[model samples]
Target: MQEEFISVWVRDPRIQKEDFWHAYMDYEICLHTNSLAFNKKSSCVRRRYSEFVWLRQKLHDNALLLAHIPELPPKNPFFSLNNARQITARMEGLRFFLEEIVRCPVLLSDSCLHLFLQSQLSVKKIEACAEGRSRYTVAEAIQSSGCRVQRFCSEEHSQEEGETDSE
Candidate 1:
């Protein structure tokens, strides 16, 4: 049998709530694995950033035999939090972190990261988000494909214009 691989990425993070205690942000994760145990499953899940950190901290205690796991993007005040730019960058960083873990044979097999990738959001977390009672932040990473498609069409039009102008 061909070797199976795992892939994971984060996307579409938005500010779910900005209130005290109940404040939260949410994002989507896409995971694919072809392992026989996992049966080549692919799934997407919604999550809050805090849940991600909780998973990261849990991994730290068990990563002694593995290479350095990538860091989770910080929720620091260095840049404005809950903004499109910050949220996108954080999601991008998380995407990188997961990609790194997947690339490593040992780290990729780690149960903690796999659980984080494939597990559903806990009931408590879902209820907490529902109770936050705040509006969703409109900003999220505009997917790269949509922008690339638009740019490609515009470039082709400009090229056609250039050809006519030269003639």
Candidate 2:
């Protein structure tokens, strides 16, 4: 899944090598031991690890990271102004760019369970909720969920997550 995501980015003419390198690193950050070419369990890669969705997240994160690069291009017309203003303006554009990326379902699917709970459910309940389980248990269960959408559910709960292409 990771390689496929990287391959797509690498093949795209719009993305330069450095951009793809950063994107690849961001993609690696998003994955676990369940998938990716280097994992021993790679052969058992789940169907739900949608390449499109995974790639979307990679690209989005890369965009956010790159958006922070200081606008220090030596000969830019805006060099006369303070560097802070130029950087701030660039950051604003980057924020908007990220917002557009966030609108895509694939990238948005990378939603963190922690963030979801913190915002929607209160912080106190989250800690109390984890009391009965081994730490690895929940993460393994999430990885086992057949698709990206299903991965969001907690362990000990076995609702069908999604219908994969093989199904």
Candidate 3:
């Protein structure tokens, strides 16, 4: 797999209220392909930029909620217990978010073509073999096929080479 450049931006703002506290964290994940423009005719570049913006907004809302919101876990009787629980929950949320984000690139990119013809032999060599070629030329052609096919060809050729060696 080719290398991918990943950039992450995180912002955390803590707001303390008399009864509770709220913290908002935002994250932006980007991929760089070293192209000035993805496609001149299409809006793929603009769309990617927009996705980053939307992700930041969504994370801010989910992470930095209102202090009084009932959706958050209730405070524990023991301060240490409450703090520990909150920290644990935050870590879990971050782990889940990162796992989800990591999958996006692989799923979004184009990997289908490589999957289809990965085992194919080159067309030119096959044509050359069909013509009147020397034995050595044909043997080299077979050796340069896909890795699995090449292995089989080499093993067969070794048997022939061994017989010649003995004579």
CA lDDT of every candidate? 0.57, 0.29, 0.29
Runs with alpha carbons beyond 4 Å of true place in candidate 1: 1-4, 18-21, 78-82, 121-167
Provide C-alpha RMSD values for all models, in order: 12.5, 17.8, 25.0
Q: Compared with the true structure, what per-residue lDDT tens digits does model 1 show for residues 1-167?
A: 76655556577666666566555677777765566534225556677777777766656656774667678888766655447888778888777767776777666555545545654536343223334522321111111111223443343444433443122
For model 3, how does the per-residue alpha-carbon lDDT over 142-164 read when each residue is reduced to its tens digit?
33323333443343444532443
Mark the regions of model 3 whose C-alpha exceeds 4 Å error after superposition: 7-13, 16-82, 106-167
What's the distance in Å from true for residue 139, model 3?
56
Query: After aligning candidate 1 to the native by TM-score, how far in Å is the CA of 52 from where it should be?
Result: 2.1
Best by lDDT: 1
TM-score of each: 0.60, 0.23, 0.22
Please state the error at residue 15 of candidate 1 in Å: 2.9
The model with the greater lDDT, 1 or 2, is 1
Q: After superposition, how far is residue 69 of candidate 2 from its true place, in Å?
A: 18
Clashes of each: 0, 1, 0
lDDT-sorted candidate list, best first? 1, 3, 2
